[model samples]
Target: MYETLASVDWARLQFAVTALYHFLFVPLTLGLSFIVAIMETLYVRSGDEKWKRITRFWMTLFAINFAIGVATGIIMEFEFGTNWSNYSWFVGDIFGAPLAVEGILAFFMESTFFAVMFFGWDKVGKGFHLLSTWLVAVGSNLSALWILVANGWMQYPTGMAFNPDLFRYEMASFWDVVLSPVAVAKFLHTTGAGYVTSALFVMGISAWFLLKKRDVVLAKRSMVVAASFGLIVSLYVVLSGDESAHQVAQKQPAKLAAMEGIYEGEKRAGIVGFGLLRPDKQIGDKTSPFYLDITIPYALSLLGYHDINAFVPGIDDLVYGNAEKGIRPAQERLDSGKIAVGALADYKAARKSGDAATATAALDTFNAHVGDFGYGYLEKPEQIIPPVTPLFYSFHMMAGLGFWFLLLFTVTLYLLMVNDITRHTLWLRAALLSWPLGFVASELGWVVAEVGRQPWAVQDMLPVHIAMTDISGSSVMITVFAFAAIFTLLLIAEVRIMLKQIKIGIEGGH
Candidate 1:
């Protein structure tokens, strides 16, 4: 049992299960928070009974989703301490600050304002109620900002220096972490995606109401909000996603290679649009051909480098040095990492023997190579590459969904301007059917972001296998199933309650 508990695979599965479950509800909470705020703002401005009822109805749904989100989110955070103690220890100095600040600043702000937003309608002044709702929206976004900052730092580590003696990373600048390009891009792209999902969700539900010919005025107004807001944000999501791609191409080329299923190095790389991605080579097969993929000519180069002709290094280019391309091979990093580890050992030994000069020299050598230290733990340079098939499909799924969402919302918005939205049965049906696709797109985006950065828990610094707390397989497996069961039960309850509320309509929902 003890031996099995130390298995890395089980530990990863445990965390993945919990994280994925938590994420299912987060985007809805993020998007719905703002939508409800906007609805309330409309009620405050117009003082219309129908608008007030609409605000309360949507707020009820938002509260249900937010409640579940809070539950699942807390579980994932706790896992950071329980299952990923090593990861916590290594980056805690730098990573802990943002998470701590998120709780101290954003979490409290949201929870406090959320109570006012949810419960203080008639009890509070209209102006105060509107302010509270706006604060809830702002607070929720700020929470997302800080969380993404932490995640972005993991992807593209900055504002930190390694402390080899302490065996951890230390924060050099909090502002740098908060304003990291990757973090900012991710936050915009992700929150924009949240808005897109919310729009789709509202449109779909409103479409259903239109189809049933019940609450036509309320549904039409909801559709108007959903279409106009969804279209704008879907466009922003694509634009921000492009910036995120550029960040990845620069900082994590191995991930970009996997995303395109590009095995061979090339000067003009294409982002594969579609085609089967299969295992072309097992580990250690240098000359193996990669999967047959349909390439979108110059798209990858244009998106990744903002230059249509820019060289995009492939998996082989990264694994084995491409001198023509000036790509430093992974093996070089692996070798440097070993030197860093050895120097770290020497530093410890010298310090133990009271040789100050020797310790200082060894520390310098370790620091020089410490950026590649995660490579030391890898048995093969080939392991630096993430799983290609999963990354490729996940990338396409997300990109494809983004385009679908854009088209759908654009058409919906246009139709909204031209004719009566409730009368168009086909369009209404299409919108009604699109609600699930939004969730699918949201999940696939996360799958691409997280799974595409595989092997490394912190890119080029710490691999996930090295980050686990060394717990047993059974222990991890038990938690995996436990979370699965818990989330499943909660989801059932939420759906049931939400359905009942939706059935009750505007007035009774409150």
Candidate 2:
């Protein structure tokens, strides 16, 4: 038991470290590509050499981020084989398809057009060059879309059926997987956040220029573009976030309960406006667990269900059950799961002994309750629950930062429109200082999403500890430290290069 626990923790830590590092570069790529496209478009429309220089400068930064992001991304693919081989095989049929399409279609196109957007500035026609830049932007987002689709499937696990014969899940409908509501919502929210990150980045640097009294014309123009763009998309991100929350309520109630820090079932649960989630709390352990909490009445009910009167299940309700809320006791699922697991063992034994008829009969019974297969491994309902501490705080941090971004962009947009940001030194300095908030908000949002769904690698279908490959704990621990060290070195190199380029200023582009 100790060895198993240690292995799971080490493997999870390794993957989490890799994922967090990779994401740092992704949002910038998402937002900067379009910003670069917009700049290139302005250059093409006005035939202005200054606009051309501005476009080239941002594009150079975009290229650097893109290259580093890609390098870091490759390790995740390798991690799947090395650390998560069991999971890879279990749902390879369903999960592998989106990844395959992303590599063949989105990634190739992004790389191809990216070269043209860079070196072909002089070699290609002006029209073709502009087209290439737009293509790169589209390709970058398409890559995001497919990756989200794969991730969304893991969250929801729809459009697939378990295959007893193959002992794996197979795709039931490709389009269903591709067009999942969860996937669509995630794509919008994620890309929207990326755009927010880019806008903040541009606005911050432009604000820095204003403070330094350098390149007034270019800096003001950049600020206007970023402020306008950020305003519209920040609104979209919040809306999409609400939609995402609604979906989570429907599909992942335990995660929602954890995020909201709900301990007991209620008809009209309040949304926690501010709270310090106490460490000692657990499902069924506390009726009111918070150390400090401020709530907006019925807000959680309305936000999660779109119905003010709807009942929201708490952690205890999710673990045990609430008959009034239409929730079945988890023990019932566990009971059925044991029978199904036994049937699978019987089938395997019969097959080994060359009894075709017995194998077929046992297989039929196993398939009947295959949906509860993961439950069979658990001894009790508490085994289904994830760690609530990270989920609770991460959600708040993400939400708080999101609102701050909206206010920052809205105020900055107004200032840019009035063309009087130079008059407000404090506001300009705040903008320059607040560049990292977007990255913080973005990472926290992911932490809430991924950590909230803990225990399960594929929701209720597969637990991550069970799904991870059979590897020694020490080996995983060794690899975890190695990856952390290497990624830290690369990140330092990237930050230094970016700072040097930015320090050189707008003149560096020419």
Candidate 3:
């Protein structure tokens, strides 16, 4: 047996693996680029040799990460066409447009300027090079915007129509897609995360330098910058993340429920503590049952409703909500019905006064009943479908890491600023050693977000089963293994290079 089940599962695993790996580099690139720009600007303004040195050191790491990010991201895009051909075809009109915009507006802009910023040290003027660097940062973030705009549309589809003639969804209005609430929130949340990611990365490396007693002035300066950025981003992450969660509550209740591990309606759902996310209703005591109870009774309510003790829907409600007798009964059919009725009313008023094409299209929609919503309406219990253990733990782990980073970074930054950064060498050494943890948290955060939305690759709109192409499991497996090997080697090489570079400082030679 070629493992038929593996084909479907394999694609998901590969996607999760690759996306997680790629994400590890993305935030660092985004954050590092901006910080590098800032460092370069400081250099340009003051003509300081130290700023130049700082920029060069950081740029080396940024370049390595950027290369890996681009390489891995290319694979994801290719996988869309190859592995997710059906998803591409079905939502191509609606989904493809944003991706196209990303390609044209974000990717090209970033890549073009990035080359200039990176390679044109001698060719471009100092100011022009700095401008190029900033543009690269802008372009990178813009890339995120378009991609999120598309993702936001997916999160909450807006201003789109199902064209029966084309057998796909089409954009009704560009502006509708742009102003989507989910996209807007996610863009802010993701951008903040990028800044935080880079800040923590810088903090970690700088801490290492301090621990080594290598360069006090430079290390302290880097710490100040990183900490300041980290503080702003951390606070913003919590605030914006809350807003994003509310958006999820409105748009994707099922996912929100999954995050909270709430399988049934609760008047006062607690903020979940680390424990078993058993949706089977079989873990602890049946009544008032949660594995390790330390929940804020009205936290979920507050998050979703700005009120205490609000009724939050569980997985059951979401499942029933999508059922045949439930809500969300093929939006296309509903639209078609409304259009047909309106057309009939118009025809009755004045058959000769109207354009025949409008009535004809309405009649076609009503008569043809063209929209085919596969099995998305059917929702099953978590008990029925076993959760991926990796995804389950990954989500919790990411959440855990986020809280940890927020807590530790806050305390340490406060301590460092109040007392001298060098005075608390233990903390600095700890922070230096722990720099990788921030990136780890980020990687895990992405893993949780992407993997938790599993079984349905394109959120709730399209199932992964139907979306995947006719690719063999063996082929996907080969690439999966190949990526693992290549990425591992690259990671080692990157760390080694960064370590060596860190040793070299303001006076120049180590």
Candidate 4:
């Protein structure tokens, strides 16, 4: 059991490392693609040579990031087959559908025009080049749309039914999976965050140019576009984030509870604005949950349910039943799940022995408790509760950074339009330093989303231990180190190349 658990942990670590590393490039690719396209569109419309130079310079950096992003991304898909074969077998029918479309349609569309957009500057007509650039932008986002759709389905597990004979989940409604509200909200929120990251990257680099007193016109123009774009998408991020919180509260109450560090259910629950969780606090303990805290009254209730007085279940309320609130205990679900697992084994055996009557009875029993099937694998009810400290801090930090981005964009835009932004050395340095925060904030948002839904690969249906392939712990550990080393090299190469291009300035493009 220890060896098996170690192997599972190692596999999880490997995937997490690869995913987090790959994501470093994904948001930049998503945001920069559109930003570059917009720059080109300006050049096409105004027939300005300076716009063309700006477009090409940014496009060069975008290309370098895109290449590295694609390389890292392909490995993540393959890891599904290598490290998580069981999960693939269980949900392949449902999960593979969108991935297939993403690769065949969205990926191919992006890759095909990517060449035209990057290399066809002189060979293609101005109109055709502009069209290709927009297509690349559309294709990149469309790719993200399909991928997020697949992930959102895991979070909510909609439009799928288990096939007892096949021992897997099958898609019931393609459109239901495609048009899931969770998917829509996740796509919007994730892409909006990516846009904000790209805007920060551009604005920060432009700030560096202003500080250095080089390419003043190009720097100012880029800042104007980035600030305007960042401000709009930042607002969109807030709206989409709210919808995502509501979805989590409805579908995964434990995660919502963890995010807010709530251990007791209440009406009009307050949100912790900033707090240090008490290290000694435990479930059902008399100790206060926080050492120091500031909370906004009724904010959590309003945010989670769109009702200021709605009851929000905490970790305690979820794990051990809340009878008055009509919430079932984790213990009950675990019992039901165990019965379901046993019935499934009996059903398979009976079918093999040609006992149709017994098989039918077993199948009925299995179906009755299949809703909590994944819980059967859990040894304790506490497994349902995710790491509260990490989730709490990550959620708050991500939110705090979001507000900062909004302020940065607003102030930067205001200063540039009215006062000469170049004259403000302090603000320029702040903007330049603030670029990496966008990446930090994007990573934190993901940590909150992924870590807060711990122990389950597919919420309430498939546990992570069951999803992993039967592999040795030492083997997985070696690969974990290997991937870390390789990814680090890739990141270094990207940064070095990008810095070289940035050093060359806008005139280098001409």
Candidate 5:
């Protein structure tokens, strides 16, 4: 059992490393594509060679980031087959559909247009070149949309039915999966973060140029575009985040509880504005969860349910049951899930033995408790609660950084347009330093989303251990170290290349 767990842990670590590394580039790619398109559009409208120079300068950076992002993304996809074959087999019918569309349609379109956008500036007509750039941007976002749709389906597991005979989930409604509310909210919120990331990247670089007193006019214009774009999308991020929280409350209450460090169920739950979780806190303990905290009154209830007085269940409520809240205990689900598991085995056995009536009865029993099937694999009810400390910190950090980005964009924009932004040396320095925070916030948002839904590969349906491929622990461990080294080198290379380009300055632009 320990060996099995070790193997699973290694596999998880490997995937996490790849995923986090890959994501470091994804958000920037998503946002920078559109920003470059917008810049080129400006160049076309006014026939301004300065706008063209700005477009080309940023586009060079975007192209470098895009190439590395594609490489990492493709490697991450191959890991699904290599490390998570069981999960792939179990939900491939439902999950693979969106990925296929992303690869075949979105990725193809993006790749094709990206060439024309990058190389067609002088060779092609200005209008056609601008169209290609816009197409590339649209294609990049469409790729994200499809990928998020698949991920959101994992979180919610909607529009699918379990096939007992096949021992897998099959897609029941394509449109339902595509247009799922969870999918929509996740895509919008995630892309909004991406937009803000690119804006910060642009503003930060621009600020650096200003501080160095090189290309003052270009720096100011870039700052204005980035600040305006960042400020608007920052609002979208917040609004979409609220909807995401509400969805979590409705669909995955355990994750919501873990995020807030809630151990006892309550009405009118207050959100922790900033809190340090007590190291010794445990489920059903009498001790307070936090060491020191400030909480806004009823904010959690409002955010979770769009109501100020909604009852928010905690980790204890989810694991031990809250009869008053009509929440069933994990133990009950575990028992039911075991029964379902037994029924499935019995059904398969009876079918093999050519006993039709027995198989029918077993199938009926399995269907009755299929909702708790994943719980059957768990050793204890406590497993339902995710890592509270990580979720709590990740959620707060993401939220705090988000608000800061909004403020930075607002203040930066105000200063740029109305006042002389270049005069504010302190603010320029702050802007330059704050760009990395966008990447940090983006990563934390993913940590909150992915880590918050622990244990389950597909929420409520497939646990992570059960979903792992049957591979040796040493094999996974070796790959983990290997990938870590490779990804680190790739990151260093991209950074060095980008810095070299930035050092060369906009004078290098065509």
Candidate 6:
């Protein structure tokens, strides 16, 4: 069992698993807290004891989730030094800046208010408490936004200077990192996903109450709120997904290729919601293991290029053809061309005097790779490239989850509309329980999105490989295992607590 497992990059493996567990709680925490806040506000305004009870019930669950999320999330920062040291060093100046701000600004605000909102319910005035809750909500979202800004920089780097002296990339403009296209799109997409998570969570608990014939009024109201939010957020997610896909196609075409399993340029590419990708050894095999592929050619055309007939490159076309000719070689050639004759002469002279033999080998290797006579060439900066395997799978996983979530939401919502949400106790229960799926989907979406662009803290600019330090794999493996074990226990405890809270809420325990 462990033999094949050893082949896995234990460090990366641990990080992904740990993060996934942490994220299960995050979206719900972000979106549900706001919904909960709204419920409490309604209670405050209307003086309805039911809404207050509902808020308290949800608050119990939120507290459980928040604790576990924080517990699992904190270790990740440390892992940057222990496991991803290289990546940290390479893009630290640029990457660290946003994360620091997130900690100092957003994280601090959220954490501070969160404690008060949880414990200060009676101690603080109703108005003050409500204000704190909303601030906490805003702080949570703000935290997400700023962190995503840093992440967006990774996906599409902007406003950075290449300092030869530092031998690494640094942020020249903080504003650019904050407002990158990647950041903006991800923010929309992620926030929308969070709303879905919250909706599903409320729906599940409300369904449970109906099943037990308990608190009919509370259950009905919860379902109404959940269904409404779900409706809006699901729509937003669909639109955001489209916009994000277009951006990915434009900025990270290879990722798009992998997501669609397209191997060549096609005027009309099929949009697939579910299908098996049998990576044919051949360039493009006639045989496919496709379970289902729904194609809407005009839609793809309209979305991608505002025309159905416009050609979109397939995976094969992208990876084998365009990637080399269109992206890689062209950039490399341009970069190679940028080396000045004077610079080359100066380097050679310095090398000759310093250590002629070693210098000659180094120069020869670099010149061969660079392709020019190593002089009089003007090269644009190298495009930041992600590690191949992680980037490939993560991008596809994110896309897969997006399509799956859409289908899940659509079917569940349909059932709710047709069958009367509270009446269909079993379906409602399923919907209520589906909260984890929604949460996981959002989390995985983020993971794939952020990790897929690895090696580049910034697109076409900073590289992750250079950021790492010369650390032992064993050290990383040890910490990864330790965290994995600890996080696993915490996750189990969180689930148990959440389930208990839901059971109590549905039973009108409050």
Instruction: For model 2, give the RMSD to the true fold.
Output: 1.6
User: How far in Å is the alpha carbon of 231 misplaced in model 1?
Assistant: 0.4
lDDT of 4 by residue, 1-510 (tens): 445589999998998899899889999988998999899999999999999999999999999999877867777788899889999999999999999888886658998999999789999999999999999988999988999999999888989999999999999999999999889889999999999999999999999999999999998999998999999999999999999999999998999999999999999999999999997888877567999999999999999999999999988989998999999999999999999999999999999999999999999999999998999999899899989999999999999999999999999999988958988999999899999999999999889888887889999999899999988899989989999999999999999999999999977863
Candidate 1 residue 380 Cα shift, in angstroms, is 0.1
Displacement of residue 100 (Cα, Å) in model 2 is 1.2
Expressed as tens digits, the lDDT of each residue in 1-510 for candidate 2 is: 435778888989999999999899999999999998998899999999888888877887887788777868778889889888889999988888888887876658988898899889889999999999999888889988888999998889999987776778899999999999889988999999999999999999889989988877788888887888888899999999999999999988989988888878788789999998777766687647788899999999999999999899988888888887678778988987898989999998998999999999998898888888888877888877777888888899889988888899899888887878898999998899888888988898888879978778998888888788888889999989999998898888878888788778876663
TM-score of 1: 0.96
* Superior candidate under lDDT, 1 versus 5: 5
TM per prediction: 0.96, 0.97, 0.83, 0.98, 0.98, 0.81
User: Per-prediction count of colliding residue pairs?
Assistant: 4, 0, 0, 0, 0, 27
Estimate the TM-score for candidate 4: 0.98
Off by over 4 Å in 4: none
**Model 6: per-residue lDDT, tens digit, 1-510?**
222123235666667777776677678778988887888888889988888877878777777878778645667778777666656765778888878877876557988888888888779888988888888878888877877787777777677754333445578988888887778998889888888888887877777777777787787777766777777788788788788877887776655655555555677665654455554323445344244455555565557655667667664553334554354433444445344233445446656588667555655554554333221232322222233344444555556655655565566567656756555556665665666677667766766675655434345443333334455556667867787788778878988877777767643554
Query: Model 2 clash tally?
Result: 0
On lDDT, the stronger of 1 and 3 is: 1
Per-prediction RMSD in angstroms? Answer: 2.0, 1.6, 6.1, 1.1, 1.1, 6.0
Across 1-510, the per-residue lDDT of candidate 3 in tens digits comes to 333467878887777777777777788877888888888888899998887777877777788778756766767888888777877887887777777777786567888888888788879899999999999888888878888787777657677776544445678998888888888898888877888879888888888777777776787777777887787788898888888878877876666776666656666666665666444464223443345545666888888767776778765554434443243433443344445445445444343557677656554544443332333232433321124345446656766767766766786778767867677877777676666777777776665555555555555445577678877998888888887787778778777766666666533532
- Candidate 6 overall Cα lDDT vs. reference? 0.66
Computed on alpha carbons, the lDDT of every model, listed in order, comes to 0.84, 0.87, 0.70, 0.92, 0.92, 0.66
lDDT of 1 by residue, 258-282 (tens): 8887777676677778767556565
Off by over 4 Å in 5: none
Lowest summed lDDT across 10 adjacent residues in model 5 is found at 67-76
lDDT assessment of candidate 1: 0.84
Worst 10 residues of 2 by lDDT: 280-289
Model 2 misses residue 504 by how many Å? 1.1
Give the per-residue Cα lDDT of candidate 1 at 185.
Answer: 92
Q: Tell me model 2's lDDT, rounded to 2 decimals.
A: 0.87
